[model samples]
Every structure is written in C-alpha cells, then in structure tokens.
Target: MKRALITGVTGQDGSYLAEHLLRCGYEVWGLLRGQPSPHRSRISRIADDLKFVEGDLLDQSSLVAAVDRAQPDEVYNLAAISYVPMSWQQADLTGEVTGLGVLRMLEAIRMVSGIGRSGTTSMAGQIRFYQASSSEMFGKVREVPQNEDTALHPRSPYGVAKTYGHFITRNYRESFGLFAVSGILFNHESPRRGREFVTRKISRAAARISKGLQSELRLGNLDAVRDWGFAGDYVKAMHLMLQQGNPGDYVVGTGRTHSVRDAVRIAFETVGLDWSRHVVCDSRLVRPAEVDLLCADPKRARAQLGWEPTVDFDELVRMMVEADLERAEREQRDVARAPTEPEGDW
Candidate 1:
C-alpha cells in the first residue's frame, strides 16, 4: 500500500484529506505538533486508521525524522501559520513556520530521498510532494479571477510566506527533478473550520443567534470579496495534483466571488434570521493591509486535473450553518444535563 504523510493533520483540510487518502487505500500517517486535542474530532473519528508522529515545522530535524518514520511516498506540507491577521502580529513567527518551513520540508525530502544522485533511479525522485499554496498569494490582485499566470502581489505576511513556499516548491521541481507541485487554493471552508476564521465564525454566530444564544456578530470589511469552495471538494484537487505525471502549480476555486456581507446574509438566512439586524462591522477586526478581492480562474485545475467544485457558494453556506446549528443543539443538551450547584452551597 502507498504511504502518505500529512503535516497539520488536525486541521480542516488535513482531516478531509486524511479521510480521502484512507478511503483510497493509502496507509496514512500524520505529523502532530503536540498532544492531541478533542478539537481534532474530525480526524479522531479515524484515529484507528491513522498513524501519528510528533513533529514541528520549526525544527528541521523533527521533520526529517517524521519523513523517515512515515517512509511515505508522498508528503503533504499543510502545516503553517495560516491565520492572516495573526501573521501581522507575529510576522517573525510566520516567516519561520510558513516561509522557512517549506525549505526545511524540501530539504527533509531531499535527505530522505537521497538527493545528489542523478536520474529517476533515486528514491528521492520517486517520492512526490504537494504544497498547499493559498490564493492569498494573489493579494492586491492585478486583475480579477486570478489564474496560475497571475503575478503574486501578496498584501499580508501570511500571503507573502505562501508565495515564498509556492516558488520554492516550483524550484525543487525544476532544480532537483522532485515531483513537487503547489496547489493555489482559494478560500475553502467546512463545518470543521476553526472558529477563529471568518467563515466559521459567521456560521457559528448565525446558529447561536438563531437559538437565542448570541446577540450579535462582529466583522471587518464586509465588502472584501473572495472565491470560496468546499473544503472536501478542494482536497480532491490536491490529491489529483500529485497523481499527475508532471509537477506544476494549479489554481483551484469556483471562479466566483462573494463578499463577507454576502456570506453573513446567506448564513443568517439559512437559520431564518436577518443578518442586518445582528451583524456589526468592527474596524478593529480589519487587517493592516487587506486583500479587497480574490476570485479564481480555475480553468487550469479543471482541464489538467479533471477537478471542479462539487459544492457551490449557497450550498457551502447552508452546510456550515446546519452543522453549527447541530453542534449548538448538542452543546445545549449537554449543558442541560449537567448538575447545577445547590443554591450557594459552600
């Protein structure tokens, strides 16, 4: 059976990708940074099927050890300081984990694959690599519906780091003949999304507000537009990229744009609530350098990998809202079952 190692295996995309790989009959192993949490409930479902290794992106030796232990034929580098706003506050940390981390992974692959030897006969040449590049790399887009050919003008440190990772993946493919490819993914969300992310925050708020547990939802730049797709659908494209005979970058998205306001409206509407009444625009939530719009031209991914988004914009919003609502209901039930303190009992 083919073996695959995934960094950031606890994340939303990582969980879905792990499940996908397992279903396809691959022996999947994941790199965990620390002790596992219940929050990784998505991957925890398939815990029996997954092999875990403790590692960190900041430590190159740990990554090399992970690559050695997993002995994977494919490595998916998804671990990074992914939060955009967090990147602003922790620019140096972002540069270390997101930017320098790619180089470390590539080096780890090289070490494990036995680089410096020539020809396809080498094991390193045989192992494939996939880097998760974000469409945020196209921040301050020169044009609408960015394709692979678009010049990267990243606005935030996070985007800048992803851009660096993208180029390095390409460099490894060209210079070392490693089967390394970068998937320039647009905004993709799912129920498993972290509450810190805007999409999930909105969905969670909508669910809670509908249940009368929340009074308001605060956000920034309601006009900032992004091309969103389903996380489940996008992970397929990542797998497809590695299956290809050639190693090349591809942009993946639904080729459509929607604003934060649009997302809020749909999310609230899904729960039968009016977003305008409950939503507030907080300037404090705005970014230092915002990426106003990011729409994708996913023709290359479609034509090359035979991949297209299965979930549309409306469907994605509804799915998140529904999932959050169910979660809220479960939590509420748990709270009701808990025994309360006997009226001021010492």
Candidate 2:
C-alpha cells in the first residue's frame, strides 16, 4: 500500500482526507505534536486506524524525524496556525508555523527523497508534496471570482503567512523541480468544524436556540461574503492534485458567494427559528482587517482535475445545523440523566 503522512490529521479537512486515503488503500500516518486526545472528535472515529508520528511545525528537527519515520510517498502539510484573529494576536508564532514551516517540510522531503546537491531527484521522483494554500491570500481582491493568476493582496497576518507559504511552494517546484503543488482553497466547512469558526458558531447557536438552550448569538460582519464548499468534496480535489501528471496551483471553491447573514438565516430557518430574534451584532467581534468578499473561479480545477463540488449552499447549512442539533439533543439528554445535588448542599 502507498504510505501517506498528513499533518493536522485531526482537523476537518485532514480527517476527511484521511478517510479518503484509507479507502484508497493508503497506509495513513498522522504527524501530531502532542498526545492524541478523544476531544479531537473530528478524527475520533478513525483515530485507531491512523499511525502517529510526533512532530511540530515549529521544530525542523522534529519534522525531519517525522518524514524519516513515516517514509511517506506523499506528504500533506495541513498543520498551521489557521485561525485569523489568533494570527493577529500571535503574529510571530503564525509566521514560524504557517510561513517558514513549509520550507522545513520541503527540506525534509528533499533529504528523505535523496535529492542531490544539483536539486535533482533519482528515486523515481517520489515524495510528492501538497501545501494547503488558502483563499485568504486574496484578501483585498483585484478581480471578482479569483483564479490562480490573481494577484495576492492579503490583509491579515494569517493571509500574509499563507501567501509566503504559497510562493515558497511554487519556488521549490520551479527551482528544485520538486513535485509540489498548492491548492488555493476557499472557505469550506462541516459539522466537524471548530466552534471558533463563524459558520460552526452560527450553526451551533441556531441548534441551541431551537432547543431553548441558548439566548442569543453575537456576530460581526454579517455583510462579509465567502465562497463555501463541503470539506469532504474539497479533500477529493487535494487528492486529485497529487494524481496529476504535472504540478500546478489550482483554485478550489464553489464559484459562488454567500454572506454571513445568509448562512445565519438559513441555519435558523432550518431549525424553524427567526434569526433576528437571537442574533446580536457585536462590533467588538469584527476583524481589524476584513476581506469584504471572496469568491473563486475554479475553472482550472474543473477542467484539469475533473473535480466539482457535490454539496450546495443550502444543503451545506442544513447538514451543519442538523449535526449540531443532534449533538445538543444528546447533551440535553445527558444532563437530564445526571444525578442532582441536594437542594441545601450550597
């Protein structure tokens, strides 16, 4: 079986990609910095199936060791300081992990693949690399429905870091002739999405309010637009990138834009609630630098990779809301079953 090592395997995209690789008969190994906890519910279902390699993006030696241990035919660098607001607070950390870390991974791959001083490979050109580039790179877009050729004008520290990563990936591909590709992915979400993300937060709040568990949902930038797709569908495109005869950057997205208000409205409507009743606009939550709009032009991905998104916007929202609703119901049931403290215990 082919061996694949995926960084950030516990994340939504990584979890879906792991499942995809497993089904394709690949021996999947995950690079993790710490002990695997059940709390990583995204990958909990397949945790036992994954081999773990201890490593950190911030540590080049650890990454080299991980590459040596896994001996993967392909390496997916998905681990990064992904959150935008957090990137602002920890700019230096994001720079180390999200930006410079790509260089370390490329170097590790070079050493492992036996690429010589001339930067040419001999082991049948093995050890392909896929860097998870983000649509956030198109912060202040120069054109509508951004393609691979659009100029990057990143606004946030996270986007700037990703832009660096993207350039380096392309640089290595050109200079070293490494089989490296970067997928400029748009905003993709799923039920496994962390609650810190706006989509998940909205879905969770909608589910909670439907069951009378939450009073209100505070949000910022309801007018901000994003091109969203299903995480599962996007992972297929990642896999397809490696299967190609040549390496090139591709934009992966739904080719449509939807506002945060649209997501919140659809989420609430799914659960038979009016969003205006519960949503509170909090200016404090707004980003210091916001990308007003981001939509993708995935013509290349479609024409070249033979890939297309299977889930639509309404369906995606419905799926997230339903999953959150199920979780809330389970939590409510657990609370009901727990033994109560004595009335005078306090």
Candidate 3:
C-alpha cells in the first residue's frame, strides 16, 4: 500500500481526505501538534486506522522529525491557521504557521529525501507535495471567475499567508524539481465545517431555530459572494492532482456563485423556517477588509482531473441543516434524561 502523510488531519478537509486515502488502500499517517484525544472526534471513525506523529508547523525540527518518521511517498500540507477572522486577530501567528510553515515543510522534505543542488533525490526517493491554496489568495480578484492564471491580490493576513504558501510550493517544484502541486480550492463546506464559518453558522442556527433552541442569527456581508463546493468532492481533486503526469496548479471549485443571503435563505428553507425572521445583520461581525466576491473558473480541474462537484448548493445546505437538527434533537433528549435538581438540597 502507498504511504501518505497528512497535516491538519483533524480538520474537515483533512478528515475527509484521510477517509478517501484509507479507502484507496493508502496507509495514512497524521502529523499532529499535541495529544490526539482532543481531535479524535473529527476522525473518530478512522482514528485507529491512522498513525499519528507529533509535529508543529511553527517548529521546523518537529516537522523534519515527523517527515522522517512517516517517510511518506506523498505529503498533504493542510495544517494552517485557516480562520480568516482569527488571522486578523493573530496575524503574526498566522504568518508563522500558514506562510512560513509551507517553507518549513518543503525544507524538511528536501533534507529528509536528500534532495541535492541539482534537483535530484538520493535513495530515499522523491516525495510528492500538495499545498492547500485558498481562493482567498485571489482577494480583490482581477477576473470574474478566477483560474490558475489569475493574479493574486490577497487582502487578509490569511490570504497573504496562503499566497506565500502557494508560491513556495511552486518554488520548491521548480528549484528542487519536487513533485509539488497547489490546489487553489474555492470555499468548500460540509457538515463537519466549523461553526465560525458563515455557511455552517447559518445551517446550525437554522436547525436550532426550527427546534426552538435559537431565536436570532447574527451575520455580516450578506452581499459577499463565493463559489462553494462540497469538501468531499474537492478532496478528490487534490488526490487527482498528484496522480497526474505533470505537476501543476489547478483551481478546484463548482464554478458557480452564491451569496451569504442565498445561503441563509436556503439553509432556513431546509429547516422549514424563514431566514429573515431570525437573521440579523451585525456590522461588528463584518471583516475589517471584506472580499466582496470570489468565483472560480474550474475548467482545468474538470478536464485534467475528470472531476466535478456531485452535491449542488441546495443539497449541501440541506445536508448540513439536517445534520445539525439531528444533533440538536439528541441534545434535547439528553437534557430530558437528566435528573431534576432538588430545591435547597444543601
């Protein structure tokens, strides 16, 4: 079986990618920063199936150690300070982990694999690398639907960091002749998406409101548009990029756009509620420098990877809402099962 190492194995994309690789008969190793217990919930079904090694993006030595131990044929560097809002709050940390982190990983691979000055590796063999580049890199987009050729004008610290990662992956590929490819993925979401994201927030709130567990949903930038796809579908494109004859960048997206308002409406509709009744636009929730629109031109991914999104916007929204509804119902059941506290029992 092929051996593969994945960073950020607890994240939504990482969890889905791990499952995909496992199904394809790959022995997956996860590079984790600390104890695995806290992250087990994300990959509970396949936790035992994966090998975990402690590593931190901020620490190069740990990364080198993890890479040496895993000795993977392919490494997916998915670990990053991914939240955009958090990136602003912790810009320095984001730059360290997300921007410089890619460089550290590339260096580790170069050293461990014994890559020489002439772009050749020793007996250890060449390791294929995939850097998770974001659509946010194309902030203040120059084109209507961004493709591989579009110029990057990153707005947030996260976007700037991702841009650095993207270029560094290509730099390693050119300088050391490493099989490195960057997937410029658009905004993909799943039931596993964190609540901090707008889509998941909408889905969770819609479900809770339907269950009478929540009354209001605060949001910002209802006009902001993004090309969203299913995380499972996008991960397939990531894997397919490595299987290709040539290493190159590709934009992976649904090639369709949706607004925050549209997402709210669809999510609420899925849960049998009207979004306007609950959703309140909060100015404080808005980004310091907002990216108004982002849409992908994924023709290359379709032709090269033979990939297209299976889940549409409606289906994705419904799926997340339904999942949240089930969770809410379970919570209600657990609360009901709890014994009542006796008054003045002390």
Candidate 4:
C-alpha cells in the first residue's frame, strides 16, 4: 500500500487528512512530539484508527530517524504553531518550530544516512513534500481575493514563518528538482477545532448556552473577517496537489469572507439565541496584530485541480454547532455517570 506521513496529525486538519488518506487506501503515519495527546471530545474518535510515531520537528535526528522509518511516498508538513495571537507570546519558540523546523526536515531527508552539508536538498526517495501554506501570509490584504502570485506582506510572526516554509518548499523544487508543493489554505474549520479558534469557540459556546451549560462566551474583535471552509473538503485539495503530474502550488478556499460577527450570528441562530447577551468581547482577548480580511481566488485551483468547495458558510456553521451540542450532551452524560474530573488544558 502507498504510505504517507503527516506532522500535526493530532490537530483538526491532521485528523481530517488522515481519514482522507486512509479512505484512499494508504497507510497513514502521524508525527507527534510525545505520547498521543488527550483528544478534544469532538475529535476523540479519529484517534483510534491512526498510527502515532514519536518525533520532534525541532530535532534533526528525530526527523531523519522518523522519515527513514516511515519511508513515506508523500509527506504533508501540517505541523506548526498556527494561532496568530499565540505567536506574540511565543515568538522565539515559534521561530524555531514554525520557521527553522521546515529546513530541518528537508535537511534530514537529504542526509538520510549521513549529516547534511548546509544548503542542500535531499537524495533519491527523499519524499515528495506538501507545505501547509496559509492565506494569512497575505497580511496586508493587497487584493480582495488572493492567488499564488499575490505579493505577501505578512504582519504577524506566524504569517512570516509560514512564508518561509512556503518559499523554501519552492526553492527546493527549483534548485534540487525535488517534488515539493505549497497549498495556501484559507481558514478551514470543523467541530474538531480547538476552543481557542473563533469558529469553534463560538460554536462550542453557543452549544453550551443553548443547552444551559454556560452563560456567556468571551471573544475578541468580532469585526475581523475570514474565508472559511470545511476541513474535510480542504484536505482533499492537499491530496490533489501531490497527485498532479508534477508538483504545483494552489490556493484552496471557499472564496467567501465572513466577519467574526457574522460567524457569531450564524452560530447563535443555529442554536436559537440572542448573540448580544451571550457574546462578551474583551479587548485583552484580541490579537496583537490581526489580518483584517482574507478571501481566496480559486480560479487556478478550479481550472487545474478541478476543485470547488462543497460546503457553504451557513452549512458549515450549522454542522459545527450541531457537533458541539452532541459533544456537550456526551460530556454531560459521562460526567453524571462518573466522578467529577479536574480541569485540563487542551
């Protein structure tokens, strides 16, 4: 069977992508820093079928060893400290994990059995790579709908680091003739989304308030706009990028932008609530630097990959809200049956 490796396999996108690859009949392997992490209720199920490998992206030895063991035909580099606000607090560690980490993996492949001389690409069977590029890189909003050729002016350290990962993938493809591609993915969401991300945070909060589990949801910057899609749909775009005759970059998104307020309204409407009473905005919760608006221009991906988003915003919101309700019900039932548990960080 064809084999593929994914970093950040415990994350929302990673879980969805692993399911996609498994359905396609590939043996899927995931890169995790330590032991399998405790899953968020919405994502706990995907944890069962996946195979986890112990490795660290920041450590060259671990990367080389993991890659050598997996010998994957395709490697999806989805691992990064992705949240923009978190980047402000963890800038130094973010620089190490989000920026330099890509180079470490590339170097590890080049030196499969030996040490890599600086500035070199990999040897044969080094594995075709797909970097998880983001629309956040177009930080200043040069154009209404961003495409591959758009000039990037990343405002946050997270965007800047992802830009490095994007260009380095392209550089290796041009310089060493490696099969490396970058997919500039826009905001994709699912029920598995962390509570910190606005979409899930809104959905989870709505589910709670609707069920009388929580009174309010605290958020920041409702005016901020994002182009969001279903995570399952976006994962298909990643697989399509590698299946092309030769590796090429593509922009994958729903090509629609909605404000954080609009998202709140949708989630509230789904759960039947007045958003004003429930959503309490705190100035402290906002990001240090925010990308005001992002909408994808998918003309190239449409013509080339024959891809278009299957889920629209309303459907996406409803689905996420429903998932949140189901999870809350499950948690309530579990808690009632078992003893009270201590709070834990996800």
Name the candidate that leads on lDDT: 2
Tens digits of per-residue lDDT for model 4, 1-346: 8889899887888889998998999989988888547653333676576676767978999998888888888888888999888888898888788888888877766566343344335435446788899998999988888999999999888999989888988877776667789999999998888877889999999998988889999998999989999999999999998887777899999888999999999999988899999999999998777789999998889999998899999999999999999988987788779976788898
Per-residue lDDT of 163-273 in model 3, one digit per residue for the tens? Answer: 999999998888888999999999999999988899999999998888878889999899999998899999999999998887999999988999999999999888777
TM-score of each: 0.96, 0.97, 0.97, 0.91
Q: Of the pair 2 and 4, which is ahead by TM-score?
A: 2
Off by over 4 Å in 4: 40-49, 113-126, 334-346
- Residue 7 alpha-carbon offset, candidate 3, angstroms: 0.1
Give candidate 1 misplaced runs (Cα > 4 Å).
Answer: 117-125, 344-346
Question: What are the per-residue Cα lDDT tens digits for candidate 2 across 64-165?
Answer: 899999999899999888999999999999999999999899988888777765776432648999999999999999999899999999999999999999
Off by over 4 Å in 3: 121-124
Cα lDDT tens digits for candidate 1, 1-346: 9999999889999999999999999999989988756567878789899999978889999989989899998999998889899999999999999999999999898888877645243333377999999999999999887999999999999999999999988888777788999999999999999999999999999999988788999999999999999999999999999898778999999999999999999999999988999999999999988899899999999998999889999999999999999998987898889999788856
The superposed Cα distance between candidate 1 and the true structure at residue 210, in angstroms, equals: 0.9
lDDT of each: 0.91, 0.93, 0.92, 0.86
Models ranked on lDDT? 2, 3, 1, 4
Worst 10 residues of 2 by lDDT: 116-125
At residue 130, give the lDDT of candidate 2. 99
TM-score of 4: 0.91
